[model samples]
Target: MSGLPDILLAAVTGFGCALFFSSIPVGPINLTIINEGSQRGFKWAWFIGFGASIMEAIYCALSFTGFSSFFGNPGVKAVMEVLTFVFLLFLGAKFLFVQSVNLPATPLRAAAEKIEARLEQKLHPRSAFLIGFVRVMGNLGVFLFWIVLTGNFMSHDWVADALWPKAACVGGVALGTNAWFFALCFAVSRGHGRFSEATLLRLQRLSGVCLLVVGLFDGTHIVWQLARHRMALTS
Candidate 1:
């Protein structure tokens, strides 16, 4: 650890830790990336990672700049939390209901191909990118994520208020996210054939159920907190 290398080394280390901690969680974004990676291919996974990482970088910057305070208001925060809960439940329901039953043999394969071809046409690179971006952006929880991360950094006095450190950290997050998605996509791609359609369908249903439970638990917790806070304010 000497000269510019010291700073660079520290930045890289910080980046890796942040990325690992942020990505290791079993969130909606991870679920989406893994699902798409297995069903689609490398390209699909890359785009999802690209879009999500870009947005994540933006969130990091916003957090560093203290722009996420908009959600600090109680009413606004509660509303956003409820919305997130609803989205989680909705996404789960969709996954649970959309069962891809096995089709008949050769004759039906032709018709399925035709339909798949149409789906392929629609799921262009741009579409994949948009889906990733929208999926991450629509969730208000991410705003809180960066806000808390930045706040923790500030409290720890880890990095100064300099621009370069912030940029480095953000870049590190993007790189880390990309790395995780790469691994996930590669692993899922390997299982493409081994997992039958029914298995995938069950996995989807299981994901939905997990998400639904998460929403219910979180929604209740948030409501309880809100009630307590309201009581405190009144008292």
Candidate 2:
């Protein structure tokens, strides 16, 4: 493929990966930041997204370097699957048990408001950059997903040889994934606001249920897979 076409294709693939994955329950950190930014301001959101993109880039680079293979061993995969399952289950249980809405007057809400107020006070470029950095660091699942996607892309023969192309592909995907944050910020900042706090809360609740279902399904699948592997070994 020509460079332009190749870059475009890479960008599409990157965008697709981000869009699909972001729809998943665990993938909503970017969305959360975006929404928060909409409520707070774009500058804050921009830094958060930028920081997340940087971490994603680092993970993609590492994945490209074959670092994820360390976790590809059957034993390691099994362990990871188990841990992931447990974590998801825990998250689901917590969602089911906890109160779904936060009152603005609640201490937790107050604390959050204070934090945002502080962030607003420090809303310089440097502070925005720091916020972005910190937000990305806090989002571990997104990092892991980026690593996996990078590993998969690196394994492909068509585009593997060209470092620039590969980097572009990764960058394209990161941008696509983080695009939601920017959009949300822009929308909220525009003041043509479509989503209310109630709407956001409802969506969050629905997302939590979806996460719960996915966790149960994945956990069951892992158990079945482990059983089959054991049976094959014995047979």
Candidate 3:
């Protein structure tokens, strides 16, 4: 393949890969979006996703530029896994322990909520964008994910070793990531109103527990791998 056809094919592959992977089971990024959407509404949540999409594109481009080896290095990969474990564990605990504001209605509660609304209003899109950026940066999984994906595409000769095709694919990744985030934010915002305050609180706690479970699983896997590696070395 050459010219526009090659570019188009690579772009489509990148788009499909980004969308499919991003839409997979609950992870830090999506969980944060869901939590924030419930609390602040669609705009805040969407901004976060937008920031993440930008980072996704950057990471995709990095993959084409051969940064994948850095991420794949055993030492670097181990540190990233450890950091990801800690990050997930921290978020899980934060969400689990943190109290939801919209409790059962009381006269004073209205005033309290008004103050909170004012505060949330002060949270500009820039702040939300930064939060999204920082959140993804902390996760490390996003970089590793792109590493594996880009490698697969290259190995299969799906994307050529050329500038334009790679750039087009990176652009497609941004679009695909944003598309999923938009749909998720829209759905969550639309359904948010239907939920009672108490229900929302429950949902928050449930998401927290799920995050904790995922973190624990990741930590366990890391430990298992380390143990096996040590045994092999000693043997």
Candidate 4:
């Protein structure tokens, strides 16, 4: 392929991969955006996506620059897993018990109520951004995912290792990620009026349950690995 075509292919590959992955609704980031959009509105929820996309781009760049080995280290991976487990546990419990989304009869009053609740650092635009960023940071799975994806892309020669192609791919990833979040937030916020507070609260609780399940799964895996290692040593 020629130079421009190579760049385009890399960009398209990145975009498609990002879009496909981001569309998966299992992650904490997705749930947070949904909760925020349904509770607050689009503007505040969208900033979460902004911060997430930026971190995603950084991860992509690191992957492209061959920093995958850093995250691949056993010690680093163990630390990340522990951190992720703890964070998931805490966030899951919080979401499970969070009372009232501040939904009032009037949108204005609802907004006012939300702002007042946010004074306790519950939810706001800036905090939403930080929440997104922090959530992704604790999510070691995302970093490992990028590592594997970029490695596979390079191995197949689907994306050239040249700086330009890699940069284009990273940019495409950021855009693709942000696009999904925007669509999700838009849909939830637009239809926010259709759902009762009870239903919204149920969804939030469901998200918490799912997160806790994932964290438990991870913990189980870690324990199993340790047990196997111990057996090997004993043998």
For candidate 2, write residues 101-212 as lDDT tens digits: 4422446445545654565466643566566654445444545655545544433322343556666667766786577556656766675345565655665566567658
lDDT tens digits, residue span 43-160, model 3: 9999999888898888889877985445545576676667767866776686666576333454554554464355445643247887776556544556766775676566445677
TM-score of each: 0.54, 0.55, 0.58, 0.58
- Could you tally the backbone clashes for each prediction? 0, 2, 0, 0
- List all candidate RMSDs to the true structure: 10.6, 7.1, 10.2, 10.5
Per-residue accuracy of model 1 over 32-101 as CA lDDT, tens digit each: 7667877788788768877777777787778877643444454655566666667667766766676553
Q: List where candidate 1 sits over 4 angstroms from the true fold.
A: 1-10, 67-126, 193-235
- Candidate lDDT scores, in order, read 0.62, 0.58, 0.72, 0.73
Task: Give the per-residue lDDT digits (tens) of candidate 4, residues 66-118.
Answer: 75445445675666566666766775786678686542254544554354445
Clashing residue pairs for model 2? 47-132, 51-132
Against the correct fold, how does model 4 do in TM-score? 0.58
Collision count of model 3: 0
TM-score of 2: 0.55
Candidate 3: stretches off by over 4 Å: 67-126, 193-235
State residue 31's C-alpha deviation in candidate 4, in Å: 0.4
In candidate 1, list every pair of residues with a backbone clash: none
- Measured by TM-score, how close is model 1 to the native structure? 0.54
